[model samples]
Every structure is written in structure tokens, then in C-alpha cells.
Target: MFREIPTVNRLLQKKWNDKDQQIHLQKLKNAKSTFNIKKRRSSSRRISKSTSKKDKIQEDRFKQIERDNKILLQKMRRIMKNHSGVNLPFEKGSLNKGMRKKQLADITLANYQLLQRLQDKKSNYNVLKWEKDRIDNKKLAQRIGIFSSTMVDPAHSKSKQALPTLKNPRESTTRMTKKRMKKNYQTELQPLEFPSSFPKRAKTTTRKRKRTIATPEEDGDKAKDLDLAKVCSIPEEREVIFQASKNDGKKYEVEISQTEDKMFIAAANKVKHSEHYLIELEKEKGEEILKEFNNNFQVILDNLKVISRRLVLLNPNINDPKRANTTRNRTRKKNFRKLNKRGNASQPSLRPGTVNSPSGDLMGVMPETARPVSPTQNTNDLQA
Candidate 1:
């Protein structure tokens, strides 16, 4: 019974082992299939993405090139329009660098042919000019008074005619002087004023000053005594005044110092009613002279007021030519410098028939050369 029980257990164990192996094999097969599908999908997606990025880059570059080409075409069209009068064989669409080279070569050939034709024409015109000059000389010789005559006059005619009688020189001078005098008398003369004088009115009249009445209450006041002492002690001083006059069309103001000499002269001029009263003097005329000085200053003040009014009426523009000339000159100098620089740049490469020389070489000197020594100086002095 033990042996039979062992055989049955072995058979059951073998069946369970076979079932487990089959389940594991199926799971491995399913896993391998899913893995292969996933790998294929990933590879296809990567390839599609790479192709899309490449296409996008290519499209962007093409668009940029097209934009640049359009801009270049517009610029070329503008040049063509500006030179519309010129007969160009190239089309607007074919104005690229390679096409321009061919066009330039064709133009050079055309210019060479035209120059040759012009040279031939110029030679022919020179020949015609020589012929015309020869014909003109022949015509000039045919006219009378131009060349020697062959036939002589039948009448008794001498080789040279007699000279006419000379007229008297005195008659010519007398005739000219009389004509000049007549002209002078016919011209009008300007009227002149004579030195004379008329009765003159006095510049001012002296008025009698009114006297003030003193109050009765101040007859015995102590304040009056103090005022009298102060007034009597005050010091006297000579006053100065300035006088202005026009001399040689220029204004001059002088401070006149009081002197005893001018005092008597001023009094005499005042009594005589003379126009030279300003140059005269008087001993008691100090106040009057000061008043005249003030009158002169008042006249100057009135003139200044008139000048101010004139300034208000006048409108001088700030941007006038006289004011802006300095600015214009600065601009002109700057432009001149720019032009000189441009001229130097344009001639950087020397021409075929020209020789290029440095400044020192043109001046007959070398940059490293030493100056000549003076004859009075000794060689030992130079060495020291």
C-alpha cells in the first residue's frame, strides 16, 4: 500500500509542473510581441519629427532669401528709373552681377566704336576749315584798297596830296573858356546867412520873494537861540557842476572849477545878451551855472527816452545774415575739410603718368637729417 501511494503522488506532481511551465512560456511570448511593437512605433515617430524640423529650417531660409532678393530688385529698379533716358539692353529681371558684367563689356565696345567715328569726323572738319580759310583769302584780295592798283589816273595827279593849313591855337582856348563861363553863370547858387543880431528876450525874470510873519509866542523862546548858534557855525564849501558840449561831432562833459577870472567875463556876457554866455563867468552866478548844467542833463534824459522808444519800434531778426554768418563760415570750413579728405582718399592710388613723393622728399630734405652748424661755432663747442 505504501508503494502504490508513492506512484500516485509522483504522477500528480508531474502534471502540476507541466501546467506551470506552459503558463510562464505564454507570458514571455506576449511580453516579447508588445516590446517589438513599441520599438517600431518609437522609431517611426523619431524619423517623422527629424524630417519635420529639417523641412521647417529649409522653408525659413528660402523665405529670408526671397525677401532679400525682393529688396535688391527694388533698389535696381530705382537706379534704372533714375537713368531712364539711357538705352539699356538688359531686362529689369536680369539686373544681377553676372548680367551687369556682360552689359559693361558691350557698352565699352560701343564707346570705342563711337570714339573712332568722332575722330574721323574731327579730321574731316579740320580739312574743311583749311579750305574755307583759303577761299576767304582769295575773296579778300579781290576787294579794292586792299592790294596795289595796276591802272594810273589820266588827270595830272601827284604821288602825294598837299597837307591842310594849321589853325591858330589861341582861338580854341578862348572858345573853351567862354563856353565854361556861360555854363557857370547858368547854374543856381545856394543862399547864405549874414552875421547879424536881433533883440533877445531874457531867459528868466527875478521874482520878489515873500517874507514869512513870525509868531508872537516865539519872541522869547530858548529854541531860537540854539538854532542861531548852529546856523552861524556851519561851514561854507564851493559847489562843482558839469558842462557838456559837442566837439567835432563828439560829446564832451567837463567839470568846471570856479575861478575869479571867469567870474567877471560871465557877468559882462550876461549884461551884453551875447550867444557866448556859456563861456563867460560871474562871481554870484554859481547857482545859475548849476541850473544850466541841470538843463543840459535834462536834454540828455529826453534824448535817452527817444532812443528807448526807437529801440522798441525797431525789430532786428536774430537769424539775420549778419548774425548767422559765423555759423555758415564754420559749416563751410567743415565741408572744406571733408572735401579735402575725400579728395585725398580718391587719389590714394597714383595715376599712370604721376610720380608719388613723400613731403620731406618733395621739400628737398630728409626726416633724419641734422641742421647745418654756424660758422662762428667751434667743433669743440658742439661736442660739449
Candidate 2:
């Protein structure tokens, strides 16, 4: 019985050992399953957290993009409104509609490109302008077809036409007086001795009567009747002039002379008239003289008058005391001193010389000696 009981106990121990081992294995499986589930949950939590942060960042970026777009749109709207009146060359229909976002962006990019191109064009335009200016300056210097004040032709600038000559010539009047004389008689009455063949002739006597001379008026009328035009067909004198001058009241005599170069005044002596009668004639002659004078002479006379007036105005002495006082206050004077000359103070100096003294104290002197030459035995030195 005791041995049997011992075997049963061994069996029971083995059974217990198997059951405990089973339990241990089951616990290890359960723990492994729990660990796997915990690891999966932690991984899911981390992924969800990362996803939430990414969503928030995307929302902020979207809001920022919208704000930037609104600002840019406002600026574009202002630009569009200000420049609405300006139309594109070929897009007249597009003027009534607002530009699309893509179109606005495209326009902005195009504007940027256009600005760059414009800047480049402006620089090139400036360069071209400078080059053109240089070319124009060169043309001006070369006296090309360009018309500039500094490059005017010398011939065109100077006047080539001469002034006209005086139309009227000046002249004068003259007068003459008549005179008569008588002579004494001493007659031999016999013919001057002429040698003949020795023949004597008796003296003969005859009665004679004096003839009366014709009056000046009758002779003048006769001369008038003569054909003077036919008789003097040719010009017999170098110069001929006919003039008349008044002597007494309403009395004038005509004169013909050959001194045409003496002008109208050549008849001045011919006009032996009263003062009142001569006054009228002198006035007429004076006007004719002025009419015949040279233009250059008139200009010279005008300039002389102006210069004389200026000299009178600038004279040191003034007729008015107020002007003299003003002049004295405005005038300035410089201090000057006379130099003390060494000798010949009264004599004027023609030139500076060692023996002569200077004209004024302004003179200065310097000591100078002849060039020194060494004595040589050669004849060339003596010649020098």
C-alpha cells in the first residue's frame, strides 16, 4: 500500500508541473498582445498630432496669401482707375471689364519687363541725342549748310551795296557892270610914206560924220531873232551852266558860266542884291547844299555833335553848385609823388643812358661791366 501511494504522488506532481507551465505560457502571450496594442495606440496618437500641426500651418499660409492678394488687388484697382482713360492700341473692347487675376499678374509682369525695356531705350535715346549733338556741332564748325549765328557767311554778314548819291547839286549867282571910255586925237592925215617912182601928189580933203550906236535892247531883240539853236549845234565848252540872281527889288540878271564844278554858289558874286532880296536866295541855296552833302559827312557831323555834348557834360567845372557838390563827393583821387631826379631835372629825356639822368624818380640803375676776355697770342683774338 505505501509503495502505491508514492507513485500516485509522483503523478500528481507531474500533472501540477504541466498545468503551471501552461499558465506561465498563457500569461506571456497575453502580455505580448497587450504590448502590441499599446505600441499601435502610441503611433496613432503621434500621427494625429503631426496631422493637426500640418493643417494649422496650411491655414495660416492660406490666410497670408489671401491678405497679400487683397493688397495687390487694391493697388491694381487704383492704377486701373487712374489710367482708365488710356487705352491699349488693339484692346478697345477690354476697356469696359476689370482685368482677371491671371491677366492682372500677366500685366504686372509685362509692365516690369516694359519698364526695363523703357529704361534701356531711354539710355539708348540719350546716347543717340548726344551723338546727334556732336554731329551738329561738327557740321557747324565745318560751315556746312546749317544756318547758325556763329557760322554765318562772311560775305552775307557784310553789306556790299553802296549808299545812294545826292540827287540835287548846289549852285550860286553872279553879276556884272558895264563901262565906256574916250580917246584924244593927233592926226598927220597924210598916208604913210610908201616908196614910188618919184611922183608928188596934191592933198585932198573930205567931210565925215559920227554914227549913233544901237541900244542894248534893240541888239538883244535882234540876237533873240537870230537862230541861236542852229548856230550853236555843238557843245563848245567843257561845262556850261545858266543861272539868274536878283540885284535890286524884282531885278534879276541871268548868267552863263563854264565853272560848273563851283556848284550853285559860283553865281554868288553875280547876285549883287539888297540884304532882304539876298536872304531868300541864301535860304534856298543852303537847303540845296545840305541835299547834296555826302551821307558819310552827315554821320561824322552827328557823331561830332554827340561827342561835343558828352565832353560838355563831363567837364570838370559845373555851372550849377549842386552838381559840383555831388561831383566832388563822388570823385576819387589817387596819391602820387614826384621822384627826385639826380641831374638835368629841367631837360626832357629822349632815352635812358649812363651819362644822362632819368626824367623822374621812377628811374633805377644797375652796375654792369664789359665781358672779360683772356689775352691770347693768336691774331684771331685781336680781331675779335
Q: Pick out the ten consecutive residues of candidate 1 with the lowest summed lDDT.
A: 308-317
- Which ranges of candidate 1 are over 4 A from the true structure? 1-95, 122-143, 146-384
Taking all chains together, the TM-score of candidate 2 against the true structure is 0.15
Quote each prediction's TM-score: 0.13, 0.15
Off by over 4 Å in 2: 1-41, 84-384
Q: Model 2, residue 255: displacement in angstroms?
A: 60
Model 2 C-alpha lDDT per residue in residues 225-262, reported as the tens digit of each score: 33212232212442433434333222233222233232
lDDT of each: 0.40, 0.38
Candidate 2 clashes: the total is 12
RMSD for each model, in Å, please? 42.8, 41.6
